[model samples]
Target: MKNRVSRWLNNEQHLAYSILIPGCALVLVFAYLPAIQSLRFSFLRYNIKMPGAVKFIGLENYQKILADAVFWQTVGRVIYFMTVGGLLVMLLALGMALVLNQEFPGRALLRTLVILPWAIPPVVNGFLWKWILNGDYGALNGLLYQLGLIQEYQFWMANALAALSFAVMTFVWRYTPFITILFLGVLQSIPGELYEQATVDGAGALRRFWYITLPMLSNVGAIAIILTLIAAFTVFDDIVTLTGSYPTFYDATKTPMIYNYEMTFGMGRFGRGSAMAYLIGLLLFALTFFYIRMSLKKED
Candidate 1:
């Protein structure tokens, strides 16, 4: 038995299975199992209010989600948020990365400072911005007043448009540093000889960046875009901290995640909530799949 066990452990296939088994088990337990459970729950009538009425009503929950005007509105808002906020984050990160990639007096210190925001927890970042943007006693209002930009303290959160803009700004601020780090690493990996050769051929700064740097960073950029896209779609803690789930404010800042939370915990409609969650997951998966396919096609 000892000889047989030793032989099995030495076998490459067995060793590989032993190494992968733990990780596979973790994924199965934490991801696949919960997802399957949620999908199952989505088909039932599982409201906390109606405790004894736990019947399987096939597609009813999905039907409600599809027909709900508020749900559709939330979907539109989330799409808008992802588009505007994701672009801003990527652009700002790229710009910052370019600046930081250069030789400077305090380049190291500046890089550290740039990454500080990304290190902050999402909920904490949200609360910090919430205070800064507070209408009556906000630092922003005081600064604007001092600058003579406004005669009075403005209620930034009271206005729906302003609130949405601020939320997007907060998302961009928190995530930009991470993207910057990603791009910076990619930028550093690029061969310096390419830029030197470009300069020898009379290439200016803008032309060098456009022709050489951008093309080299294309794969990294695509990956960053997909990551930011996923993060934007599943955003929750920041929105919750910045804007509490007030029904009045729902029209402006209600993301799909927020809507799911409101339904599942706030209203105790587990079935409907599960359905919405699945729908969002499906949409996200489809979008990511489409992007990956397009990217692969281009590569081919």
Candidate 2:
């Protein structure tokens, strides 16, 4: 038995399988199993409140979702939110990465400070920004008023546009630092000799950045953009904390996750909610698949 076990462990393929088995089992149990169950639930008329009414309803839940005007509107709103928020986050992160990549006094301390916001839990970040943007007694309004930019405290969340903007701003603030760190590492990996050679050829700062920096960071930027796109679409805690449970703002600020939550818990429509969840997952999967394919094609 000992000789047989030793030979098995010595075989590379067997060893590889042994190492992978646990992780694969864990993923199967934790991730894929729940997803399969959710897909099953999506086709049934199961409600937490009405457990006795559980019945297989085929694609009726999905049909209702597709035919709902509000669902389409929410889809549009989420797309808008993802676009604006993702762009801002990527830009801000790239800017920070450039600045932090340079030598400066107290650069280490500055880098630490830059990462502080990203380290905060999403729920905490949401609550912190919510307090800062509060309409009647917000610190932002007070500061602007003090600076003479505003005559009085502005209700930031009362207006749909302002609320959406605030939500995006909070998201950018929280997520930018992580992307910054990612880009910073990429920047550091780029040999300084490239910049030095560019300078020797009489390249100015902007020219060096345009040529050397952008090209080197292209792959990293693509990955970062894809990640930010995913995060923006799936955002939930930030919206919940920023907007609370107000029904009035649902039309303006609801993303797919928020809509799913409201349907599942708020209205006790588990079947429809599951259907929406799977639909959103499918959309994300398609987006990611196409993006990865495009990136691979570009590489080729």
Candidate 3:
């Protein structure tokens, strides 16, 4: 038995398995176990308020969700936010990266300061923006009034479009810095030789950027765009903090994440909520898979 134990411990494959087993177990317990439980719940009729009434309902929850008009509206809103917010983030990040990549005094300080917004916790960032854009005594209102831009303080969050647009701006402000840093790092990694070669060929600065910089950054750009879209897709705390999740604000700012919270906790419809979670997870997975396929094709 002693000899057998020694052989088992000495084996390379056994050693590798031993090293990985704990990490794999932790992931299974912490990540996948909950997901599996949620998937099981998705096919049932479970209510938190009436736990005893749990029963198998098959795909009824999914069917109800698919046919729900409000769900479709939320989907449209998510798509809008993803497209607009993601585009703005990428554009702003790229521009900022270009500017920051240039040599300048205090460049290091500026780069460090730019990361501050991204470092703020999501909930805190939401609250900060909420106060800044508040109708009464808001910083924005005061600034605009002081500048004589408006006769009176505007209720920026009152109108649906206005609220959504502000939310998008806030998202861009918080996320752009991180993406900028990402692009900046990629920019710094690029070979200066390529630019020198292009210059020798009589290529102008714009042409060098267009031909070399843009092409080199394409892979990271694709990743950043998808990540921004994913973040926008599941946005919750920002809208909730900005609009307070009041019934009046639901139509204006409720994303799928907010709707899921309402269903699971507010309405105590656990099963339906689980189904919604699964659906959203599937959509996110599809987006990630699409990104991977595009990336692989690009490499090929």
Candidate 4:
């Protein structure tokens, strides 16, 4: 026993295991532990009001969720936001980044201005836009009416499409700068020689940009897309404020985050809420996994 213990103690494998202990413990306590609890709660008919009265409901919660028409609608809304809105933000960010990388007057100041929206808090941004986009007395309607562009003020958020558009606007306004900065950092690292070669070969500005600048920026764009996907999928604050959590049926623009919030906290359906939360978590986990895999492939 002593010989075996001594051999194990002297092995480098033991040192490696010791080093991983803290990391493993951290993941267990923070991530896996909470996940397990949530999963268990999802199987029960639980509510926060009646703490000790949880009853096992098997897959009833999942069944009910699948059958609910509203559940599918929210699912569609989330996909639209994550795919279409997220792509718009990323494309705008890339354009801004490329423009800023070129020499121009007050370039530094312009870049600083572009980053202000991203620096502000999400809730604050939501409220600010609310004031600006209000139907009765908003800056947008006020300006347009004064300019004689319309017969009267338009109600921007009274409809689902308008509200969703503004939500996407707010997202792009706040997050495009992040992509801009990332692209800027990557653009700076690219040697000027590539551009010089293109110029020497008589490539025009458009050709150089299309071939050289864009190809060099692909990795940066990929990183930006991953970040945008995560944010778009998990978004809560901005959308909540822009459109109240429980709007009229025709005005329902709820995302997965909103659904989770309403079920868990608002309606007090803890078990069902827990299931929705886990569903969102699963989507995030899969997105991150694929993102990392694609990034590794690019590296290779």
Candidate 5:
């Protein structure tokens, strides 16, 4: 039996090598390599100034992080960002999907235009919105003033609420296209006869959407939501560009991941920074696990 198995694998050597090579390389470079380095570095006191003073302090980094309140505050900010951004982005995407799914003039053009924000890089998107929300020459303030809506331009990023709202808006703009594209694909997949039958039975547009369209799209919507949630929680570049601890220097808008980068690179605490990165990774993995478990239980 052992010889037979070896013979089979040996006979399919080229095919097995092709499948294993790329996947194994990725695991080695991305998953296992950095992880091993992080584990070793987390236990030691590493800094650029004292490269020779590296010594194992065994959990000191974790203990110090635990004593820091700013870390927890940043965690709170991440939760708020994920929850609020997820809801608004999904809603906006669903609305766009529904509108574009209809037979209307310029629908195709509108669909293409709506997805532009998502196609842009996060850093660019954030700065673009920052410009649009600028106190002096922002398009928003200019338009409002022209409409006689406000007497003066508001300093949007100066106020905490406005800054946070603008950051959330950037998130929505970048992610909504992802939602819209997914929902549109699912909408296109749905059979047209369902809509025709509903209309024949005296169903109006609203009724058809609620009964036929919505029900058909629910599974796709659920999957889109999960994908968006993951993306929302993992967001970094946009927040860093738009806010970057904005409206304040310390913990004003620090996501955990950004905090980790600052700790490692900016503050020169390599060991602690690596630990913080690991903590963020663990939190993300836990959140993903819990969500998947709950979803499975609900289906059961």
Candidate 6:
């Protein structure tokens, strides 16, 4: 028995399985277990502040979430962010990638500088933008004043649409670098022979880029769009840091994630919060499925 056990342990497959067992177990405990608990709580009246009052309340929380006007408004704001912010990010990233694809002096330095914003944490980026957009004494205000663009320092975040626009801008500034890198990598991989052949065939720069560059980038561009939309859905840190997570739903900058935080922690209604999370997850899953299907159809 001892010899058999030793042989089993010495086998390569057995050793690999043994190595993976710990990690698999950790994921089960830390990730899957919590997810299961959250799902269960979503169907119950599991108020953390009133543990004794916990009880199964099937679909009640979900019903409330579906009917909530504030929730729908938050959804609208999410759509705005995804569309506006994603468009800007895609354009800027593509432009930067095209520029970086060229051979020029200090190209490496420019690439590094382009990627610098992606390195900053989301919350930190939010605070940085907040300072720049501050109403009282922001750098933007000072600059505009100096340029005679405005007679006085403007309250950039005072209006709802303006505040949301700035939030989207901050998100775009931070995320565009990563997408640019993605586009640049794919751009670099396209064979130079294709461009040369097109040039020899009397194709202009515009025509060659249209025929070669755009087609090669279609896949990555779709992926980048999906990623940007997903990121917009989960924009909590920036909103919280820039606009302050007020418990009220009237705050224009309150994204879905912030609403979830308010419901769960702020109100101690874990059940409703979990339900909201699952609803958000459902929307994300649907969005992803639809977008991917569209991309695949376009490819076909």
List candidate 2 segments past 4 Å from native.
1-23, 290-300
Estimated TM-score for each candidate: 0.89, 0.89, 0.91, 0.86, 0.86, 0.92
Clashes of each: 0, 0, 0, 0, 0, 0
Reference-based TM-score, model 4: 0.86
Q: What's the lDDT for candidate 2? A: 0.88
Order of candidates by lDDT, top first?
A: 6, 1, 2, 3, 4, 5
Q: After superposition, how far is residue 55 of candidate 1 from its true place, in Å?
A: 1.5
Tens-digit lDDT track of model 1 for 159-274: 67777778888999999999999999989988999999999999999999999999978887887888788888888888778887444554588888888888999899989999
C-alpha lDDT of residue 203 in model 4: 99
What's the best-to-worst order under TM-score? Answer: 6, 3, 1, 2, 4, 5
The regions of model 6 sitting more than 4 angstroms off are 1-9, 245-250, 288-300
Candidate 6 C-alpha lDDT tens digits along 49-133? 9999999999999999999998998889988988999999999999999999999999999999999999999999988988898
Model 3: per-residue Cα lDDT over 112-188, one tens digit each:
99999999887888889888877888999999999999999888877777777888887888889989988998999
Error of 5 at 12 (Å): 5.2
After superposition on all CA atoms, what RMSD does each candidate show versus the true structure?
2.6, 2.7, 2.5, 4.7, 4.5, 2.7
Better of 2 and 3 by TM-score: 3
Give the poorly placed runs of model 5, Cα more than 4 Å off: 1-12, 15-19, 202-207, 245-250, 290-300
Error of 5 at 202 (Å): 4.5
Clashing pairs in 6: none
**Worst ten-residue run, lDDT, model 3?**
245-254
Residues 134-249, candidate 4: write the lDDT tens digits: 87798998998889987787778766767777887888788888888988888888899988998999999999989988888887677678878898888778877766643662
Local distance difference test scores for all models: 0.89, 0.88, 0.88, 0.82, 0.82, 0.90
Residue pairs with colliding backbones in model 4 are none
